[model samples]
Target: MMCFCASAKNNDIIDVTRIQHYDTILKKLLYFIDYSKKYTIDDINDTLFSYTANTSPFNQKKLDANYFIKLTLANTGQQDSFLLYTGKAQRYKMYMCDSTGKKILLKNQVTKFSPGLFTNIPYAQIALKKGEQKVFYIALEINFYNWYLFDPVILRTADHAYFSFLHLLQPSRIYMAITIFFMGIMFCMFAYTFALFIRNPLWEYLHYSVAIFIFMVYFGLRLLNIFHFGSLYFLFYDLRYQGLQLLGHMLILLFILSFLKTKEKMPAFHKQVKALIYLQLIFLVVNLPLTYTNTYNYAANIAFDIMRVLGLLYSIYVSIYLIAKNKKKEARYLGAGSLLSIFMACLALYVDRWGNFDELLLRYSGISVLIFMAGVMSQMTLFLLALSYRLRMQEANRIRAVEQLQLENDRKELEKYKAIIDARDSERTRISQEIHDDIGSGLTSIRLLSEIAKVKNSESDKKELEKISATSNVLMDKMNEIIWTLNSRNDTLLNLITYLRHQIVEFFEPSNIILEINLPENVHDAPLSGNVRRNIILSVKEALHNIVKHSQASLVSVNFSFDKVFIISIKDNGVGFLHDKITDHTNGLRNMKERLTSIGGSCSISSNGGTNIELIIPLNTYPV
Candidate 1:
């Protein structure tokens, strides 16, 4: 119980607009607890007679029964109106007493008490004349541990208290707005997490979403109840608010359990956690309405205290266990959040238990929940971060899996194509061997027979025999060329250059011409197909033959260069011919152009002091 007196002597009238602030808490007043709910103002003053000073903004204590408080106000010089406001009373009724000891009702009713919400705490305007004084008394019926702020304002008139009190309330209202803003943030997080739960259907997301929602519920209820918004006044003073707190704890525990994967990682610990949750649930069910069952119930308090201690221990144990098991990320988050939450909870419980010993701490009991709220929001935020990391990991794993499957399929298909190509190459080898060994040998034998016949024949038959010999030699050379093209070992560009060197050296050895072959030392082993190789080799042979037979050159040079296009340049120190002369059918230069064009290549011929020929082949003409 607490009361105050705010009376000052006035010598003369002052300006009506002049605002004065006063602190009434330092005065001595009388109060007593009426255990039987039967105390009148007269009975409390006469029988109890115990006076105490209310020298603080508020005083709080456990009122196990009815409590009675009294206050006095007087005007020694001028008649004035005074406003008195009380805050956060569970239940109270007020009556004013005169010097003659006549009592008059000033609040709700004499027989009933108002269960006050935050803003609706009862207040009254007391009018006093010069040298007049009055005493006001209230009987308080507390159903819970709460605070009483003895805030009284004396004014020249009653109307100025609203504006003044409104000004005084700005700080608390800002505090309330901050809490509501946090509530809105938590609401958005709840919506997002629930959406994640819908899409991914994970236990952690669902539990975290529910836990965040519970925080929003708790804050929103407090905000509404403080402002006396809607029907929150009734719920604020009822057992339902307690249920929300219980649910918040339960869901927080659930989130921890799911994220930790306790069943998979530590089965024994998981079972113990489940048992703890069950015990809390059972205790909550039994503890409801327990205050109404007894005048001063310690059963609920004892049970809750046990649960709170056990919960704190369990959270610490789980956090440490996770860290030891190498889940450091989850461990740190859980540990930080759990320690903060448990600390705040323990602080609140301690304040409830020991508030009667200290008015200053008890007065700020409502602010304690913000700490707990921050802890819960922090825990949920960490869980959200963990969930994001898990999802990214899953995505990366999925992409890796897809790449592995594609690689397997590609390997199998490549093997199949390789087998088919190898078989085709084998069949071509067989045909080349048959033509070279069988047809070529047969042609050589036919030439030998024709030559023998020519040696034995008369003059008229010698010509025919010689012609037969020449035709056989030509057919055998063509067969040998076919064999050269079909051989796999001769498919590389290096082999082509070697063969050209040998053929050109052999052909020009019987002539007066000198051959200079320039090839790159780092010659690429560019692969060539049978058709492309045959055309390129034949074209080079034709060019060399033309130079020896018609250009009459003494020196010839062949240069090969590689870039985006493969280049082969042939030059000779010979009498140069006109473009029309080289274009003649006998020169076979047109054949070279046609052969290069067939394989996405080109041929160029030029003449200055000597004959020069260029064969240009696109690197993409044949696969490397």
Candidate 2:
């Protein structure tokens, strides 16, 4: 019995027998192996007889070189046909010979596997007669990507050889179906995450989508046939088959780093993690270009094994560290999901070797790889669950930020409304003060004149009437001034200057004092707040009035300048008055000081070179 057959058949007998057990049928045949790279049909026939190594019904382990497997079929059975079943390999050949060492032609058969689909198994047909034994040798050039362990050769009646071939195809067909299903699911996930990227435009979503896409390609590459493909195809095939795991590790690291905000939250650890990612990238870059080279192609199998384990360990460590540091959201999603992914991936890693535990796993076609696909499905499902939850949290935070911004806008709008109302009330108060100080005094003078005129004759009556006319006209002028200040159209500094120029020209036209006004060159149309305008107008008017009434000055000068502040200096060539006496006049210098203070301004009175009243008001700012 050969390694591929079961052992219930006779050990040391040659008889025409029909065996039912497929494993026992071929496994009981004798077999030997060789490692000669230059072995041909003649070499296999001549040298195969001297070899003495035995393998079971399946060769589940990988060999580093070309191998020649010789099986002596002792068909002591009524079965007239021997059907050999094996997975597709990069290169293979089979020859048959008898005890006389004469080569006999056997039908060369191989299932034409689809390019990217895992759909078929290859078989070899060897015809036999009852109680006739023949020796067959299969020369295999092992390519890890397309190799699958073979079961014991099927021993069937000559009429049922076609059914035996169909039986051999059943396992791979199921494997192809399950793999396509898994691929479909992974592609769906990729599409879903791509949709997420379109919605958010976040880096995390984009990175995660790319990582999932890589996984889809990785799974596809694992199932595709690598034989007879072009060199470039084999180059990529070798990279994906051997080093794609390295790339996956790097992508996984990057996805975690970006998803967790590790750079902002854990700078030092993030640097270490970043270094690991770069190292894995270096391995990928180095290996990708060397995939076709003999040294790298041969050595990649071992190198990526260490690379995968180390990369996964580092990733898990980073996740655990993040969990410890109380990054609750990231920990909640990444910690548990990453562990599940790692557990499942690790489980998948050993699934192909499950034959050690249950030989039936290897005896069947798709059981081991199907379990691997299930493991992949579990991993991706858990990962997607975690990612979806994280995205929900991100969406919530975005909505919260929008709400906070809206609340801030509402607050500012409320403040603006309040400021407008306060301006209205302050203007009303200013109008009231103008009426009382200017119009009311004018009315009082008219009333006094009327009273004095009642006690006098027609000549005194004429003088009183003239005085009443003057006071009445002055009151009317004061009313017009109040109107001018209250009008919203006169809110600019230029308007204030034009109005002040008119008032100063009119007030001094009849006086002996010469008024010299100096203004800034750049005619600013900048807005003046009601409060600033009101306080400035009132203060300037008071200072000018003081100069006209009591300064006894011959000349007065007013200069307006702006730097960090708006400044108005009114100086007169008059004798100085005591500061104490000035304070006694509440609506005079004291009122000027009070008004300036109200608008974040100040006033200073100096009696040198005339009474110099310098008023400084801050130029207010408005939001953009």
Candidate 3:
């Protein structure tokens, strides 16, 4: 058996002949802490250095300080060129020195550029000859506020370097492919849900669609950042992304509350969820300054992590509660989807945090992101199902409500018809009573007078004949008045005015009185009830009779004007009388006043400037 000798300590010369493709040089490295940032290549001595014992390849120790590394390589084989990869760093400087460490042959500075699929990994080419040795001094600057994974230092031959670079790129390529696929799914979901919101204008649908859009943007920016595709490189690794995440969470909570009607159905749980949402907002507000100023970053990160955990727990609890207590299939679907999503999300977070540093775990890192996306898609599908079910229920309720309203309308219409029929019967009874009280008695008296005239056949009988003729004329006039009142065709105010003008002219024709009429032009054909029209006409007739008999006025004027109230004024240029001196005409005036009052109208008589009679009728008080 052949025996091999290994280096006793780190910082020992590494033999390049023994180094294979993609070999890790971390175990053979030594580091020095530069607390003051004042260390130079000449100042870096072996006395100030320490071996990286039991340290991770990521070099996570003393993150607040800058680090310098010492490496020595010996070429004892036919290979004349090698490649050195120093992983990721904010900025670094490499010093190439002779074997004696007395003079620096070359100095190279490398700084991080925007990350990309094939760039951002810092590497250097090394040229060597047989039996040649070289020393390389590297200085690394790290920022404590940013979390980053520093990969192990790798050594490879020229031919194997390209393959090693491709190997390192495998995870990013897979992650990019998965991100693109999920992005498509998220866009489709957003479009569909947004269309639903537009169609229904429901707050729940709007919240869900907006939440989907926000998450889509978040994932899209993350994909772009990973590939370094755009100029928005600073947005991904800063407070903006965190702010976006918080906003997305808030929208999701709002969606849940609206979708489930939690305030109405689960008041206690609603309050708890509302409180959680408020706390998240507070954290979001507080984290901005902390992150921007690079102050209390660790504390802020811890608080955010706690909030996320609490949010996840609350979501799970509510979903489970709904599934257990509610019998709705929508609730069951939502609960199952929520639980699965939360599980996958938790797995994703855990894996992303720990997987990047381990070589074996790195292969699955991209899959974790895909798993989270899958969970989201599943949850979205279930939410849509629940929405469809709710829409169906709402449609059913709407149809029932419409049917009930139609039935109520039909009942009201029937009652209206009954009321109309009753009113018609009452009017007929009133007409019959009037005919019996007035017309029947007049006809009986006329018959008795005619019988008396036939028996006597003398001068007194002639007087009885004259009396019968006058009585017949009076009966005919009363019959005409009754017929006019009963006619439905004369129900308009215009018709009433026309009839009144004709009656006034006829009554004054026999008398030597001049009649002057004043009436409004273009009067609206407002409806007048039969009872109202009859009462008004009678009042006007009584006034005119008093003017012809008592006032003995040579000139009379009748004026008509209308607004919401109808006014009729009759004036006579005759000898005016005081109230005490008008005893003979008192009954006639009283009748006129009584007639106007019956139709919710008022009559005022004054003796000044001849007798003036004013009738005021409020049209609104009478029904059409």
**Candidate 1, backbone clash total:** 0
- Top-scoring candidate (TM-score): 1
TM-score against truth, every candidate: 0.80, 0.53, 0.55
Tens digit of per-residue lDDT, candidate 2, span 1-624: 112222223342323255463433333444334333454456443323332244442232434445555565566655676555544344567767756777654554643333232244344665667667766666655544443333444544342334433444443565667778888998898899889899878776787677778777877765563223322344356566556566655666677778777799878877998898788778777765654544354466556656767866876786577567665664565666666666655665565433353334233324555565565566557667778777688789999999999999999999998798668857766776777678777677776766666567587577767777676777667667666666666768889888888888888998888989998998667777655677788888888888888889998998988887778888898997776666536668678888888877899988876799899877655211
- Show model 3 residue runs off by greater than 4 Å: 1-11, 17-21, 35-41, 53-62, 77-81, 98-122, 145-147, 152-161, 172-179, 220-241, 263-269, 288-296, 324-332, 349-364, 367-371, 395-624
Local error of candidate 3 at residue 413 (angstroms): 14
Q: Is candidate 2 or candidate 3 better by lDDT?
A: 3
Assess each prediction's global lDDT (C-alpha) against the native. Answer: 0.67, 0.64, 0.71
- What lDDT tens digits, residue by residue, belong to model 3 across residues 372-417? 7777777777877787788889899999999999989998997897
Error of model 1, residue 67, in angstroms: 2.9
Candidate 3 global Cα RMSD = 17.2
Q: Report the alpha-carbon TM-score of model 3 versus the true structure.
A: 0.55
Q: Which residues of candidate 2, in runs, are more than 4 Å off?
A: 1-26, 36-83, 98-101, 104-121, 128-148, 155-185, 221-238, 284-300, 350-394, 408-624
Error of 1 at 246 (Å): 4.2
Arranged by lDDT with the best first, the candidates are: 3, 1, 2
